[model samples]
Target: MARSPKDVSAHFSDVAEVYHDLRTTDQEPIISIKNQLGHLLYKPSINAADIGCGNGRYSLLLPQHLGDRLRLTFADKNRCMLNMLTKRLDHTCSSEVIQSSAECIPVCEKSFDFATAFNAVHHFKLKDFLAEMARILKDGGLLFIYTRTQEQNRCNIWGKYFPDFCKKETRLWKERDFCRVVAQTSQFALQDSVYFTYRRVSSLERLIEQAEGHHYSTFWLYSDKSFREALDRFQQNITAQFTDPAKIQWTDENTLFVLKKIREAR
Candidate 1:
C-alpha cells in the first residue's frame, strides 16, 4: 500500500519525545554525513536553513564545526521536534525555530547562505521543496541533501526484519535514480560533493531499539499488531543472521550531495 504523507508526518511527531533518547548513538554512516556537511561549510559569516531539522540535530552539530559564524533557522513540519530542539539549544548561537513543511518554507527569498536536510529528503516534496530552498538561499548558496543508500546495513537491519516494515521501507525510499533527478532539478546546479562510506559496529538488540524511534520508524503507522508482528519476525531474522547477536554488527553506506544554487536562473 502507498504511504500517506500526513500519516507519516503524524507518526514521527507523535514519537518525537522518546525518539532521540532511544537513538542517541548514530551509526558511522550518519556520523560521516554530518561531518561531511560540516566540512562543506568552512567559511566566514553566513546564514543557513536546516529544513526537516528534526530535533535540530544538524542545527546544533553544524555550528560546532562550522564555527560560530552562522545564523541558523531550524525548520520542520513537526512542532514536537522543533520544540525539543528549541529547549535543548535555547541558549546557544543565533537561532530561530520555525514550524513549517519543506514544501513551503516561510523564510524570504535569497535570505540564507545555505540550506540542509539530513535523512529527511524522502519525506519532502522534492520539486517544490528544492525550489523553495533554492529561492530562499542567496546567490551561490549551498544545499545539502543526504540519505542512506541501502537499507540493509546492520544499522538499519531492524527495519528489514519485519516483513511489514521491510515492505513499507522499500517502497518509501528512493534509489539511485532519484539522486540523478535531484541533480538535474531546475532549482540548483550540482556542485562539488563527496561520498563517504563507513561501517558502524552495533549489537543486534541495540539496533532494534534504535529502529523503534529513529527516522525510519515511520513504518509504525501500521496497526500495533502489525508492527509488533513485524518486529517479532525481524528479531527472529536477526538471530538467524548472527551467531552471537551481541557480537554481530553491520555496516552502512550513506551519501551526501552538496549542491550550489545558481544566483542567476535561466
Candidate 2:
C-alpha cells in the first residue's frame, strides 16, 4: 500500500537524520548515480531548483568544476530532509531553500534557469508535476530526470523466485511514459534519453541499510506490522529465497531522460 501523505512525511522526517551516512557515496548505487548525472550538472544559470531533494544526495553531489556560477534552490515538502540538506552544504554556492510539493511548486512561471529532480519523480502526481516543472523554467531551459531501471536487483535468485516484489517496485516508474506527455504538453523537447550501467561491490549490511534508508522495506505486503518488523520479514524473505547462494550478486542500472524547454510558439 502506498503510504498516506502524513505517514510518508513522518517516515522521511525520521529518515533525514543519518540519511547521508546510510547511503554513503561509497555505495555502489552512488557510483551508478554519479555516472548517469555527471555531465548535466554544471553550474546552474542565475536560478535553478532541485525538486524532491530528499536528504539532498544530488544537491550534495553537484559537480566541482562548475564553481559558484549559478544560484541554486533546494525544495522539498519534508522539513527533515530539507534541514539535513541545509546542514550538508559548504556555503560557497549561492542558494536558497523552499518547502513545496512537486505537483504544485510554489514558484512563478518561467522563474528558473533549470530544474533537476533525481530519483524522486515516482513520488509525485505526474500530470500536475510535469506542468509545474514546465511552468517554473525559463524558455529554452532544461530539466534532468534520472532513476534506476527496474531490472536492477538486490538478490537475483530471490528476484527470480518471488517476482511480485519486483512487480510492485517496477510499477512505480510507469510515470516514465508521462515524460513524453509532459514534453508534448509543456512545450519541451525530448533532447535525449541515455542509459548508463554502473557497478560496485558492497557489503550485505550496507545494501540493506541503503534500502531501509529509502523506506523500501515497507512494501505493501508488510505494512500491517511495525516498520521494523516489516523490515525483518523483507530481509528474511529475500534470504530464504536466495539460500543456496551464500552471498548474492547485486546490480543497479539506471536511465536518464534529458528534456529541454523550447520557446513556445508565440
Candidate 3:
C-alpha cells in the first residue's frame, strides 16, 4: 500500500523512526486547522477522520481542542507511519489508525461528519480524492485542506535561497486548481480559501541541520551533488543578504481550502 520509493512517503518511511526529531515541533499549519475548527465542531459528539494522518501529529494535538467526546479515524498510506502513531495513541483518544491511500479510502459511505487533509493533498490524485471525500462525508459535512500553493512555495526561504528549490518540487497545486476541481466535483462547494503567513525564526546552524536531514520532502528531489551545491549556494546567499546569521527570519505562507458537502455523492 506504500507509494513509490521516490515518493515523499518512502523518504518518510526510511526515516520514520527519527522523523519527529527532525520535524519542526510546532507547525503553524496544524495549529491553524484546529483554531479554524474550534468554531465549527460544536456538537457534543463528533466523528472525524484525519486523512493522510502521517505519524498522527494532528491526531495527538487534536484531542485538546476536540475533547474526549471526539472519535477519530486516522488514515495514511504508510504502514510505518501508522505503526509509529499507534504506540503514541494509547489512551489518548477513541481513535483508529488505518493504512489507506487518499484516492481510495476503505470506509463506508457517509461515515465522517468532519474530514481533513493537512499538508498531504499533494500526494493524492485530486479527482479521485475529492470523490472519495464526497462519499465519506455526510451532507453538509466539512473538509479542511491545509497546503501551500506553488506561488507560496516560491516565497519560502528555501525557494528564495536554494537553487532550483521551487523548480524541483512539482507536486503542489495552486489555489485556482483546487477551486476548479471542487467546482467540477459538483458534490461539494468550496466555502472559503484562507491564506496565512507565519513569521519564522531559526538560526543558520539549525537551518543547515534541517536541510541536511532533508526535513522537507523537497530536498529528496535533488541528487547528492545538486543538493550539496544548492546547500553551499543557499548558505552563501543568505549570509550575504543579512548580517545577523544567528537570528535568521523569514515568512512562510500556506492556504486552507474549506469545502462543504452541498449534496450527496452522485
| Candidate models: Cα lDDT each | 0.68, 0.63, 0.82
Candidate 2, clashing residue pairs? 1-220
**Predicted model with the maximum lDDT:** 3
- Count clashing residue pairs per candidate: 1, 1, 0
lDDT of 1: 0.68
Give the clashing residue pairs of candidate 1, or none.
Answer: 161-234
In the range 27-82, model 2's lDDT, one tens digit per residue, is 33334433444434553445778899987787555634345775678889999888
Where is model 3 more than 4 Å wrong at Cα?
A: 1-9, 25-40
| Candidate 2 or 1, higher TM-score | 1
After superposing candidate 1 on the true structure, give the runs of residues whose Cα lies further than 4 Å from its correct spot.
Answer: 1-6, 24-44, 150-155, 170-175, 212-215
lDDT of 2 at 167: 51
* Total clashes in model 3, counting residue pairs 3 or more apart in sequence or in different chains: 0
Candidate that scores best on TM-score:
3
Show the lowest summed lDDT stretch of 10 residues, model 3: 1-10
Residue-wise lDDT of candidate 3 within 1-266, one digit each (tens)? Answer: 32332455477787666667776544555566656665456778788899988887765777777788888999999988888888788775788788989988889999988798877898889989999998999888889888889999999889899899888888898778778989998888888788888889888998898898888888887777778899999999999987899999998888889888887546
Better of 2 and 3 by lDDT: 3
